[model samples]
Target: MLQNKSMIVKLLALLTIPVSHATGQVPIDPNPFWQSGEAGVYSTGMIWRDCNNDGYIDVFFSNGNDMALASNTIYISQYGSLLGTASWYSANAEYSGHCGVGDIDDDGFPDFAVANYLGTGGFSTAGLSNLYFNSNGLPNTTPDWYTGDSIYSFSCALGDVDGDGDLDLAFTTGEGYTTKKQRDLIYFNVNGALQTVPGWQSTMFTEGMDVTWGDVDNDGDLDLAFCYDDVAAAV
Candidate 1:
């Protein structure tokens, strides 16, 4: 215990060491530059990519607050440091923190599929997850397409689930506030748009917090995995 205390003291001393600041550059600390919204109070998730094609990676954060009218925000990068000249794009969303990015429009620029709910109602806020097509190096103000689903969406995965040479979407949802219709869904990519497969049946008909595509079975094809929020135990 004495040796452990000495090691901890040394670590603390190292952390307190003063870092020299470069001209006009922000010094990084042990704390992550990525911070949640509302001064680190409400946060859901975020993505880092070059949204404007300026060669500098930008950032997008989903609002974890369900009651806040503005639920999404984007920050453009300036290529200097993490903190530099950039701007924000804010929009109305409902607890929209989960998101996926891809070039759905085949425009060589990545687009977004952020998990969002439609309408202002607090009950079962799942109406349509947004599909923001890349427009002039930024996400379009209006979504190019929607999944057209009414089920509550917790998160989504965007990839080529069908090996169709393009990206597809997998939407997941969890039961919210005694909501009855919670299910996971997959939409096939067809000519830059998405469509539901005919006669396709879903085994994950219950609650799903997240979804992804992988070859867990190693059958030479991608498989979808539905992730439910639960406590994990490590052995």
Candidate 2:
């Protein structure tokens, strides 16, 4: 009976040691569960959206900047698989700075808009904004429309500001190498294309860097907000 009791005490000691170590402690995995190959070189401005309405989110990436290897292309991934790539404009000397997704034509499918900061023609001449409309819920490589010359676009945002059923675009711009500041633009969607809204440019004197819209006053109307790069005070 004495030997049995001693053996039982040793067993309980081992069990209690493990319980003390595990108290308030959580196990963590140290190894990576998954990995994937690099999609593109010098990639920037990545965004995920439900482009095809298949309930699975898709990804879009822009590979730009380097002239030798830069394709100035947008790569798409659907359902965790690469769905090919498309370039809507001439890739020569073009850096795809930023991109935004929205339904510009009220077609229930998300479209893509990109800002070409510096193109082959150089800063002042090559800056432009391009828009690609999604056709039949698939990614379209071709741009439906592009901004006029000398637009100098940088970052873009999409929203419905006027309570209209269609989406609108607000983009920022600035001189690439000079002190000249550019005005922010608001393009209203009209008849499946973007039209410039008059007197919508920001009156504050600053170099626009980014833009977005929200109803800040609880008035149900969307108010625009612009972020500046050189302004001393918040606007």
Q: Against the true structure, what is every candidate's RMSD?
A: 9.4, 15.3
lDDT values, one for every candidate: 0.59, 0.58
Name the runs in model 2 displaced over 4 angstroms. Answer: 1-41, 65-93, 124-126, 196-199, 233-235
Per-residue lDDT of candidate 1, residues 170-191 (tens digit): 7766554454445567777887
Model 2 lDDT, residue 26, Cα: 32
TM-score of candidate 2 to 2 decimals: 0.70
Q: Candidate 2 lDDT, tens digit per residue, 39-139?
A: 33345555778777877766554445322224334333445554333323233334565678888887888888876555546553546677778877665
Residue 108 lDDT in candidate 2: 86
Clashing pairs in 2: 93-119, 93-120
TM-score of each: 0.73, 0.70
Candidate 2 C-alpha RMSD relative to the actual structure: 15.3
